[model samples]
Target chain A: DQQVKQNSPSLSVQEGRISILNCDYTNSMFDYFLWYKKYPAEGPTFLISISSIKDKNEDGRFTVFLNKSAKHLSLHIVPSQPGDSAVYFCAALVSGNTPLVFGKGTRLSVIA
Target chain B: EAGVAQSPRYKIIEKRQSVAFWCNPISGHATLYWYQQILGQGPKLLIQFQNNGVVDDSQLPKDRFSAERLKGVDSTLKIQPAKLEDSAVYLCASSDGKDSFQETQYFGPGTRLLVL
Candidate 1:
């Protein structure tokens, strides 16, 4: 079963605009959420993360908002840049020493 | 600092053949993990080791897959008598095992395997 899901397969936005990526999860045990950005032939790099106790976390131009009641979360990038174009994977971390459960990923393209 | 290192970026083998992939995690990292990512799908954890000791292997297919981390460092993952369905990118990741909530995993480029 897919514990985490990213409904949108792809997204496109113009440079200097805002980009939003969404994710959902079915497992309530997950208390940590993370977003990773991946490029072709390279490993995924960490972007931003949020804990269940917080509704939102911000890092520079990236912000993650969590809505526990809806079992959903989103990553928002304001003034997106071409360098931001990549496949983004949303992952959920279960409490304790456990591996992350990842979603299918969403590909975002930022036009220059 | 050097990132995680993986050997033989790509490998091709026929079904029923054995294949082994190697990984060297970032220096001083106490936790190592192996994952399998199929095409068009997200990565799935295969096994995890904390300082040369297994922390989790519940998702590993022990019947055909085996992994080991020696001396609390570098690791190796092997698949014996592989099946066509075993084709996927094997990813190695590492993190400091100090705190679960603050830990951030760093991944390697991955080793892509193709089984005929």
Candidate 2:
């Protein structure tokens, strides 16, 4: 019963290219979505997030787009760098207090 | 400015053994969470604490898993009579105790457990 799902298990992109990671959710109760990037030995680090009321949020090189009607969200990293190679997990929750439901994660590999 | 802290970065234990993992959230953050990340899978929430009180622990395996936050700052998760499937990276995360939708959770390096 995975409420959040990342359909792609892996993605490969060239350096300086744009990398897009997609995630879908079945639960409409989830109003907040988050993207976390994780390196090989470290815990998942918060990258970006969006709320149900908004359609897009961007910070630096990362941008997140949310479509409530589609129950979908995506993270776009422009000009991908080698350092961006890592497993990215998408999570969703109704609010801050509730535990987040996470996707299995998509491993992104940026070839240099 | 320090991130969440976890100790004993790596541990190897046998089946039926007992193991404990500790976590220290960031200063002034009142929310703490413990998650289990198996290989090729995302982190699964085991428990969450807000100011020493449990917010959620529904997914916890109560029979073998127990956790406590004595002072509301640091927490410990223990698994008694562990099973091989219990081997995974235990992650501790924290966030500011706010009721907003923009809160971001900070994570620790994580403690990797290998049950043999």
Candidate 3:
């Protein structure tokens, strides 16, 4: 059974627009969540993260929001640039100390 | 501040052959993890090491897959009599091992394996 799920497989957005990627989880014990961005032929790199204690966390153009009660989280990127075109994986862990469980990933393409 | 390092970027072998992959984690990092990522799927945990000790290997197929990190600084994964299903990208990652829940893991470029 997949503990985490990314319903959307791919999304496209024009430059200077906002792109949102959503994720849902079935495990309620997961308290820490993270987003990783991966380029072709490279490993996934850390993007942003949010804990269940907080509803939101932001860094530069990237923002992550968590709705613990609903077991959902979303990553928001404002003024999306072409460089943001890649696969995004949503991951979560239980008790803040377990190995991450990752979703299939969402491919986002930002057009110029 | 060096990231994780993996060797044999690409490997191809016929069924029943043996293969091995190596990994070197970041300097001073105490935690190491190995993952297998099949095409069109997310990476899955294969094994986890904490300073030369095996912390988790539940997902590993011990009958054909085995891993060791004797020195705690580096690790190697070996598969004997490989099968076609063993084809996948093997990724090695590491973290500082200080934070309980907020630590960030750095991943290596990964070694792509193809079993013919």
Model 3 iRMSD vs. native = 1.3
Q: What is the Cα-based TM-score of model 1? A: 0.97
Question: What digit string (tens of lDDT, one per residue) describes model 2 on residues A1-112?
Answer: 8899999999999999999999999999999899999999899999998989899999999999999999999999998999999999999988756888899999999999
**What local distance difference test score does each model get?**
0.94, 0.94, 0.93
TM agreement with the true structure for every prediction: 0.97, 0.98, 0.98
Worst-scoring 10-residue span by lDDT in model 3 chain B:
B96-105
DockQ of each: 0.75, 0.73, 0.74
Ranking by DockQ: 1, 3, 2
| Candidate 1 residue B3 C-alpha distance from true site, Å | 1.1
| lDDT tens digits by residue: candidate 3, A30-94 | 88899999998888898998888999999999999999889999999998999999999999987
> How would you class the docking of model 1?
medium
Better of 1 and 3 by lDDT: 1
Top candidate, metric DockQ: 1
Residue by residue across B1-103, what tens digits does model 1's lDDT show?
9999998799999999999999999999999999999988999999999999999999999999999998899899999989999999999999988886557
